[model samples]
Target chain A: MKSMASTSDKILDIAQSLIVAGGYNGFSYADIADAIGIRKASIHHHFPAKAELVAVLVDRYTKQAAAGLQSLREQAASPADQLQLYIDYWRSCIENASQPFCVCAMLASEMQMLPDEVALRVRTHFRNLAAWLTSVLRAGVEQGLFRLDKRPDEQAQMLMASVHGAMLSARALGDPGLFMAIVAPEIARLRDT
Target chain B: MKSMASTSDKILDIAQSLIVAGGYNGFSYADIADAIGIRKASIHHHFPAKAELVAVLVDRYTKQAAAGLQSLREQAASPADQLQLYIDYWRSCIENASQPFCVCAMLASEMQMLPDEVALRVRTHFRNLAAWLTSVLRAGVEQGLFRLDKRPDEQAQMLMASVHGAMLSARALGDPGLFMAIVAPEIARLRDT
Candidate 1:
């Protein structure tokens, strides 16, 4: 069971990195097989199909995001600071060239090409995160730490869009600092407004 | 000559749509052939290779963007208004489900997966648009129509990122209104800031 779990985990890790570097249609089990030095049939044994593999990947990514958000809630001092910390988290990821892009966000751009199950999971991840953001911002608004011009739900969408778009631009220019330059001002503007 | 030009033009139209619907890897000469009722050989006759096809598509897309920006410059009143016009342009595209996504921006996300020539063109497209945006914002600042918290170049990156990210979110949620809901406020805040 331990060995089986590690194999599946390794598959997911490689799959995610592939999706981040490319898109859904960009990689195959064969690619994964070559990466981890496993046979293609072995990947088929674990995932059975590409859709299943991507669905599982999206689910795992959502859980990871939830855990990160939970940690942010517990550790951060204020809502604005937490928001900055979130931006900073991506900033470091992108700057360090460790994991410069979001898997779900990257997959979301190719939404129409994704399988129904995988696409639904991607949407669910965004919806869940957007809802989480709305709640956080609402809390900030009630506490006088933030001035949200619209409902937290709408503002959350704006912030989410900004972060995702910043990722695209940063990647487009191959400039890590541009991500922070684009995101920090908007975040700072959120409080001022 | 006219017939050849139209054939390549049709090819560009289909290629851009396919790239927008998926990503760089989503479509092939076969897909383009089926869409246009032509043989893959004819596509190769025009493009020679997938990278060449996409290189032409990106160049055409950049030109279209330039024309749009020029029209906005001629028609719009203030620098802030020009920025809003830019948002309105994307909002309408997403809302009306016509050219809902920017091909260059979409391709930019999958930059690592694209050919060197194609990816270079995508990066060039972004750099050109960012420069255009920086100039507009700088003019706005000089005119006192807008207050920028960062350099115009950085702010332009921010605005460009926000727009691209918003497109991804709008597509992810399958909601067009969210595009405007996400973008209008940010543009509004940009002027106020």
Candidate 2:
């Protein structure tokens, strides 16, 4: 059972990199087999089909991301700090050339082509992330740490959108600095008391 | 000559829709041929190859978008208004379902898979758009019409990112209302002076 679990994780790591590099439709089991040095039949034995493979990939990504955010929430002193930490995490990811693609961002871009099960997971991830952000923003507003002309939920959506957009802009320009430049003000805006 | 121009435009139209529906590698000449009721040979006759087709598409898209922005700049009374008009144009495009996929957004999502020429064009589009946005934001700040903690260039990038992010969020959720909801406050924030 342990061996099976490890293999599953290995498959997921490969899938994440492939999806990030191309997209949902740009990869196939043969490509994964080549990268992992496994038979196509073995990939099928684990995932059964492309949709199932992506569905599991999305699920795992959302789960890991949620845990990371939860940890930040527990460790950070305030909502504003948590927000900065989140942006900083993305900045580091881009800067290191590791995890250059956000799983949700990649899924969001291929929303139309994704299977319904995969697409639903992507939508759910956004909703949960947005909800958590809304809660944090509301807490900040209550503590007099953040200013807002709108509701927390609305502001949360805006913040998320800006982050994703910055990722796209930065990647397009081939400059991680561009991503930082775009998101820095947003972080500053949240820091503004 | 006019007939050739119209055929080229048709090819672009089909390509854009396919890219939006999938991504850079989503479609082929066969798909475009079927959509436009043309022969595969004809598509090759016009485009020579997939890379050339997308390169021309991106080039033409940037030109038309630039012209649209220039016209908006000439018509608007203030930089803030100009920026708002720019957002409004995207809003209208999304709302009317006229152009559901932003060409740059689509390209950005598949940047890794794109050929060098197409990738260069995508990068140029982003730089041009960001520069235009920076100028508008600078004018607005100078006019005392917008309040921003960061420099205009930085703020503009943030705004651009947020707008694009909102589009992705909205599309992922399959809700146009969500897109507007996310961008409205960012726009309102600029107006808060």
Over A15-117, each residue of candidate 1 has an lDDT whose tens digit, in order, gives 9999999989999989999999999999999999999999999999999999998889889988877787788899999999888999999999999889999
What C-alpha lDDT, on a 0 to 100 scale, does residue A47 get in candidate 2? 92
Q: Which pairs clash inside model 2? A: none
What docking class should model 2 receive?
high
Runs in model 1 deviating more than 4 A are A1-5, B1-5
lDDT of 2 by residue, B2-78 (tens): 45558878999999988877888888899999988989999998899899999999998999988988888899999
Total clashing pairs in model 1: 1
- Chain B TM-score (each prediction, in order): 0.93, 0.94
Using lDDT, give the best candidate's number: 1
TM-score of chain A of 1: 0.94
Score residue B120 of candidate 1 by CA lDDT: 91
TM-score each candidate: 0.94, 0.94
For residues A1-193, what per-residue lDDT tens digits would candidate 2 score against the true structure? 4445576678889889889888888788888899878898999889998999999999998999899999999999988888889888989998897888798788888888789999999999999889888999999989888887678888888888888998998898898988878777775776544
